[model samples]
Target: MFKNIYFVCFILILSSCGKDPLPKPSGELRLEYPAHKYQSFNSDCAYSFDYSTFAEMQNAKQSCWFYINYPKMKAKIFLTYFPIHNDFALHVKEAEKLVYEHTIKASSIDTKSFSYPEKKVYGNFYELQGPTASNVQFYVTDSTKHFVTANLYFNSRPKPDSLAPAVEYIKKDMLHLIDTFKWK
Candidate 1:
């Protein structure tokens, strides 16, 4: 009886040994985003542009300052409009200052300048890479009468790895706005 029991145990162990157990391959988080679309946004303010229809526009504390909220992604693009009256330099300086302030946490920053001379639109767009409060910033202006500065922020703490997708999606939207931007 003891021999029979030992033989059965041996067979069971052997049967389980056909394949080496592979450590299950590490898993990566998969995120899916919807196809983006935009609509024209124009007001009596100094600026007009196309904005993502996916985001809801909310009035901010100031009249011309408002937020484009992405509720699904828990992000917001805060936009401020300033009517330049010989203070264009001041606004530009402040925008650059705000972008530089994130240097402490930003591993790197890349900038791309855009201009539509026909539209009198020109500005620098900054993409901040790292775990920072604001990962994107830009100031658009006609260089004379209208200056608009925008910042992208997530409601939660910045996690570059997890937030990469959202950042990219919103970045495209920002670019669209810049492309279609004009002053009335």
Candidate 2:
């Protein structure tokens, strides 16, 4: 009789010791961002803007624009869209020059470091990388009245391998934006 009573008490205690279930994430956690967002550039400018809310945006000091922050992941996404007046080939050459300049500037203390050119995305443009920044730059024009570029930047010190997943996520979002992009 005593053994039976003890066994029941032990079982009861063990069952009571089990932890309570964790609460589920709230509505905010459940919310999902659209694949992308599109914004026409200011009426005076010949550009357009598209990005994912997965990152936050802020303005930069120079004509080059703002900073995009990914706090939880400790990363940044940068955009610098510049207007060009030169011919397409010249604009592309200038973009390459800018990449070289950035690489030299970033690697001033370490001449051994090098930057590389990345293949164009969407098959019609080009991109370049520096020792300190990875850039995705491409030009767009409708044959007259507008010539602009969309440049995406990220710190190069961090091996892209480490940030690949997040970068890919953002890239997919950006790709969606590009696919649907239309000048206003």
Candidate 3:
């Protein structure tokens, strides 16, 4: 009986040696983005803009159409070019339609108009919030000869909370591109 009692006490002491079970503390992931560096993208197309060195440029099937692919982020900026042969309004409408299509999943969309009279660049920048498949879209044109539309897409499902850092980093780069855009 004494031996069994000592065994029980030993087991009890051994069990008590472990610390109390505790839930893990909640934490957010920390994402780091590299410093921004840009290079001039020159093509035989109607326009030229500065693109990030971090992104790889791929030739699209159509002339003047290209993709700025970020392999590390698994994101891409698609650029489509159309020559405006008295179809400026149509091109603008088409670009707007594409952005509006995301309204079903987007919580909100904010539009910013860009105008550079000297450069002849005019367009709207759309920033979509929530779980929309695309977070940003924009269209720029000289309103006479060249119309270009751009969209940013990620390969993975968009969880804004997780993608916030990458999104913000890319956002600045995109804005830089838009600001420096020149019609050739």
What C-alpha lDDT values do all the predictions have? 0.92, 0.49, 0.93
| Evaluation by TM-score, superior candidate among 1 and 2 | 1
| Candidate 3 structure quality by residue, lDDT tens digits, 1-184 | 9999999999999988877899998876797878999999999988899999889999999999999999999999999999989888899999999999999999999999999998999999999999989999999998989999999999999898888888888888899899999998
In angstroms, the error of model 1 at 116 is 0.7
lDDT of predicted model 1: 0.92
lDDT of 2 at 143: 35
Answer with 2 or 3, whichever has the higher lDDT. Answer: 3
Query: What is the per-residue lDDT of model 2 for residues 1-184, given as tens digits with 9 covering 90 to 100?
Result: 9999999999999989877899986532222334545443343334445656666766667564556565555555554544535565665566456555655434332112111123112212333333345534444444333444445555445444454555556656555545544455
Which residue ranges in model 1 land beyond 4 Å of their true spot?
1-29
Candidate 1 residues 1-184, lDDT tens each? 9999999999999898877677987655777778889998877787888999889998999888989999988999999988889988999999999999999999999999998999999999999999999988999999988899999999998889889989999999999999999888
Which stretch of 10 consecutive residues in model 3 shows the poorest summed lDDT?
25-34
Steric clashes per prediction: 0, 0, 0
Model 2 residue 93 CA deviation in Å: 1.3
Judging by TM-score against the true structure, name the best candidate: 3
| Colliding pairs, model 3 | none
Candidate 1 backbone overlaps, count: 0
